[model samples]
Target: MKNTLIVLSLLGSALFADAAKPNIILMMADDLGYGDTGFNGNTIIQTPHLDQMAKDGIKLTHFYAGNSVCSPTRGTFLTGRHHHRYGIWTANVGHLPKQEITLASMLKEQGYTTGHFGKWHLGTLDKVISSKGAKRKPAENFAPPWQRDYDRSFVTESAVNTWNPGAGNRAKNNPFYENGKALDPDDPTLAGGAARVVVDRAVPFMEQAVKDGKPFLSVVWFHAPHEDIEAGPDYLKMYEEHGEGAHYYGCITELDEQVGRIRAKVEELGISDNTLIFFCSDNGPEGKTPAKRRQGVTSGLRGRKRDLYDGGVRVPALACWPGKLAAGTESDVPLSTLDYFPTLGNLTGYEMPDARPIDGQNIWPILAGEMDQREKAIPFIRGNEVSLVDGEFKLLLPKGELYDLSKDWSEENNVAAAHPERVERMSREIAELLESFKTSHAGADYNDPEFKPVGKWKNVGSKKK
Candidate 1:
């Protein structure tokens, strides 16, 4: 406890000393698993850079993505509200609602430049169907990054190849658009590994922000190891002995290298002391088995991808803000990507322009070691699966199973019968939250007293099935 108090005191001072609109870079991996990196104890995958990154800063042991999938999780990260409140139920199911305020829009109000790189599955990049007979039809859910408050963006509507992103049929259908202009497929800038291609765009954006002497928010979401997973010859050769695992493992290693690249760039630009660099996957790995090309292991956790279990949402997370965060520290404080907005907002002293139910609480206190247990329960909903990790107990509805995550990380034992009172209380709390989410989705959150010109909430999910 002595060491904890000392770390907390130092972190508090550091946070204040560098809290004046410091640069922020949020990096996310596309379907990376908890057991995929060396820091998380995977011996086969070579992630030296990521391992060193954990040593250099705080490693989050129990971090969670906002959802078990990409699109909804992205929405939560940007808006600090449940995606259900905005009608994003699942992947490729909805677009970002214009009525919702994003982190980009928030930071932009504070005079920060914002840029988004890599897969933007929140909406379509091309609104009109290509006359050339591309696979993507006229996008009914058309919401591009440029339209969503990003100053400069190089993004795709959805997934592309892990390598040679621009040269494929997928590229023809859903191409990378820079500030609303689709790039030529043969553009030389679209070459090399997917992670590298993303970082290549991100680095210049940060440099220019520095050159302009403005604090920046650079969101780099890599598509490596997601689907159509491939790696360059060098990366494949590194994991050749793993058989089919080579493609999956190699793509991740390539992704790790780019993570190191971003860290190195921040240091090179002399912004290491003020810039916050965070890393995590959008969700847990894809596929049920670690066979064939989809070899994302969840470190012995229960479900994969779509399930509302630890393996589906719990992810490997690392945060490095040199001179502010303590080195070689670990926190099991059940954090979610939902906390990004509130945390950054508090750090920068930016308040929401209007009153709304922001599901994410400010977690700087948790990160600074002032607190351990989360005050607000992290809730999740996918289709009919509803669960909320409240303190140590996670209550899964419909299934009616309760697991004390503090004791059973694998969710092997159910203690609902033993703790009937606890289960009853938590269930009531979840029901209240779901009802609140329903009200928010129906356009109650917008049309503030100031009469801001916000769009009406469109029910994207109604058109889904």
Candidate 2:
């Protein structure tokens, strides 16, 4: 009887361990460059919290966003598929389709409370009151976070002033919308730092989930240092050498402080061990005249925001899950935001719908240090631009430039003529992937036969098919 009781106790412990699911918090910086933080060897900025997070987490050395731009990469984060597959080809081009499944919808099935805090450029926030010079969605094109399966949402339609988000644009604007209504313009709770207000809304939602004894997914996408950058006087004093660019550098430090707050909240709630936190940028720095004044750095990497070179798509990525992922560990394996859906799906036992194809693979094994490389190569497309990276060799087509990333990290050498065979192989791969993407974009992925385009163009590519 003594032996039988001991065996039963051990079995119970194992079962309970398997039942616990990690809370997921995904944070992304707005137009943050590759070498902007200390983790990536930046000497100019003092991002103590982000630097500490890197020291305590698993650093992904070659991680990439879905696209070189904002909206497309966000689409990839939710669906774990290419953005072109669902019609969000460019920033503010369309909304996330009702037919497509999202990570929030998947987590909801498994009883996880989900919240989205920060930028929501997936579609229009309201039928009226659009920000000037900002892309506005038509009444029919309206798709907000509530419509996208997020349980609780605090978001803005697009970029806003980092210091004064409520004022000083072409039109009188209050972009911070809660649930489904806009927040009061004079809401003093969000008067100071925009990043602080974003985290303020997020932490409460997380605390409520813990009180309810439930798992959660919190998305914190800060609008810091995006455009019209301005930092508080205290933060501005931190970087006086940059002059007018002080706002740009100081705002990043402010955002880092909120990161520390969120980290502390998890510890205060005693959920740090059972929670997974991932941080990255939406894309590279904005390339227009905004970048000229923003003073962002790309770590000596060539190309900026809208281009597919390593500088544009590659952003700083870090993952932390105490007692799960080892501290201070780093890997150079290439990864994309597209892998999030399949990875989380495997963790929570969520089976993907069979009617469509999923571009992302199960990367949980890679995260746990079981594998060094991905099972499939990541493919990218934005307008006429396309790129295919298989381990060290990278193919950037239209120009057909080939670079061995292992040897030439900056992509300065044009080795296409040296290795014609490799170029031919990658070229064939891009063509096949493009055809598949075209089929998916034309409504073949869903059961709806009468689906239609939601925005400006049917297909906006630099080169015609």
Candidate 3:
């Protein structure tokens, strides 16, 4: 009887251990320039929270978003597959398709409580239609409700209003809200615009998850420093003291403060050691043109948000899970948003559905310090333009601009003329890969004809846009 009781007690302990899994919080910044953070060598802006997070966690120096824009990158992050695979080529002001599997849905299968706060550009249900009270339109390219796949979600159906200077759209009748509660947009006590709203919602969600003793996955996507740069009086005044760089610098500081709040809350709940936090930007900076008068830089990379260049696609990424990832470690291996699905699956021991073809690979070994090699080349496409990076040699096709990324991170020089053999081999590889892509919709055809050859296979050199 003594031996039997001891065996039963051990079995109970094993079951309890199996029930506990790490909570995940993914935060994405909108239009955050690569050089805007202190760790990335930004002299003007102050991001103490992010800088500290980098110091306490693993920093990904060579992280690349799935796309150079907003909606597509989010799509890739959630699905762990290339955005183009699901017809999400760009931010077309619509929803994701119903058939595609998302991270939230997969997590839900494993008894995880999933919630998405902030920008949900993926799709909306008919009940939360964007048309106020009017009859629903023909749905157009909108994603069906099935695609959203979240237990609880709050998202802006349109571009968030960050343009209204002193008063940043957080009124009682503000369009950005969930369940009829107006989000605090210009609250001096909170962060700025959309970030303020996300933080407020996220705090309570984290509290509730701890109470319920369930592993939670929350995605907070902030719409700040995107456009119409709006900074509150106090934040604006702080930057103004620093002279000409106030407006841009102030917004970043406000964002950092909000992140600090969330971090503090996680610690307050005594879950900092068990929680995993992933922070990154959807893409590079926007509003760099003269007409916009935007004060931002791409850290010396070429092109802006819309272009398929490094400035557009490359972004800062950091991950922290106390006691799991080594503090202050930095990984220079190229990583993409698509890898999140398999990595999470491996970590939690949840079986990801294998119904469809997934382009991303599991990076668990890399994060666990067991492996150092990234075996596959990342493929990128925007309209007719395509690019493939095999290690340091990035072959930009049709235009056939080859840049040794190891030496030229800015993409200023075109060495395709110098390496014809390399260009030809990469072009043929891209051609064979493109053949496998299923282009069922005419969306790819509805692009600016001028940009068509940008991703094509050809040999051109010494050109400027």
Candidate 4:
């Protein structure tokens, strides 16, 4: 039988290389900063396609943004945990809790085809939009994104108008919904630069999930230089010498021309080496100072956008996958965005279930340079403010302050009195990790008692059982 046809052609070439997985997209960038792009150096923000997608791959210099704001760093970048365990403790408060477990419902249970598009501040894309007599109550955050698994959505229940985004009062009170309907408030493709109307509905949902052969995830979350930030008139005449910082550097060079139109639609669907593409910023840069349309800059990194420091939880990461990451490399470690759901559940072998408390680790061996540091230790919180960081120290908490971020990377010297036993061992490990994030914020990692614990539980550095 010719050795059983060479073991069934090596098991059909290992199931065609496990069904040729990687086609993720992830890209975020609202309230972006860490020196708003030119791939983190920002030489006057032209962002030649995010400086050639960080010179064609992997730049992630000490990334982060698992919460310095924006819906608790987008619910710890889709549930690798730590968005105050469940109650998304910030920015338009709590929501995304249909018994949490996302990254588009675990990559739509690993067959993928998820979508998402722009600015879904993690809930309330209209279940009859009426937080009547407003104070933002949209039916206690209705949780959309096509009911949180998103096999296609075009979202936006927050911040519109980075130029004509369907006209005014925050786009007639948070418009653009699609896949759960809403869009037409005169929707002529919602006109112009809101990152090219969110990559014109994310390039037709990555060309209909590569014309239905599947494998996609495309969560392109841009709202470019957030707020009512405007620019169009040729991206404000291409920043004519930055007067009023030319609409925040022309709405971040019109969101870096839709990140070069999603890297030229993954090299025109040849699927640029299986297509990975990540990017960052959901925090850091919305101003405590630099105004005139808040010219967001943090290359000096101290504090911005609701200060948890390091310019409000770092930012500006990048990735890309043309033949699996490695052009003009750079790393710095300390990644986050809560390691994008356990590094895409360890690059699609998928098994991410120990039923909760997954504060994001499997960083694909720190993005395949095969690790150097960071083996967990990146906690933080707001409204009572606590911090941690760990290797190469950080601490902070109720102002106990420490910082040796490899010899004060602008956390300006406060050795916590020359290290009182490393601040009593990271203040008893941030009080036993804020009492295991207050027992996963009292829903004990859900078997859903209808997902309880709705907001305001800031016990911060822990204790008071």
Model 1 misplacement above 4 A: 1-19, 130-139, 448-465
Model 3 spans with C-alpha error above 4 angstroms = 1-19, 124-138, 141-147, 163-174, 179-192, 241-245, 289-293, 439-465
Q: Give residue 324's error in model 2 in angstroms.
A: 0.8
Q: Give lDDT per model, in order.
A: 0.85, 0.82, 0.68, 0.80
Which sequence of candidate numbers ranks them by lDDT, best first?
1, 2, 4, 3
Candidate 1, poorest ten consecutive residues by summed lDDT: 454-463
Q: Per-residue lDDT of 1-465 in model 1, one digit per residue for the tens?
A: 446544554564455655568899998998999999999999999999999999999999999999999889999999999998877888876678777888999999989999999988887776674312343333656778998999999998778888888876667667778889988888888888988888888999999999999999999999977987888899889999988889899999999999999989999999999998899999989998898889999999999888789999999999888877889999999999999988888777776788899998777777766788777889998777788998888988877899999999899999999999998898888888888887887778987444322124432211233
Model 1: C-alpha RMSD to truth? 4.4
Weakest 10 consecutive residues of candidate 4 by summed lDDT? 4-13
Query: In terms of TM-score, how similar is model 4 to the real structure?
Result: 0.35
Model 1: lDDT to the true structure: 0.85
Winner by lDDT: 1
RMSD vs true structure, all candidates: 4.4, 5.7, 8.6, 22.5
| lDDT (tens digit, per residue) of candidate 2 on 342-396 | 7777767676667587887666556667667776678877667789888888888
How badly does each model clash, as a count of residue pairs?
A: 0, 1, 6, 0
Poorly placed runs, candidate 2 (over 4 Å) = 1-17, 132-135, 170-174, 288-292, 455-465
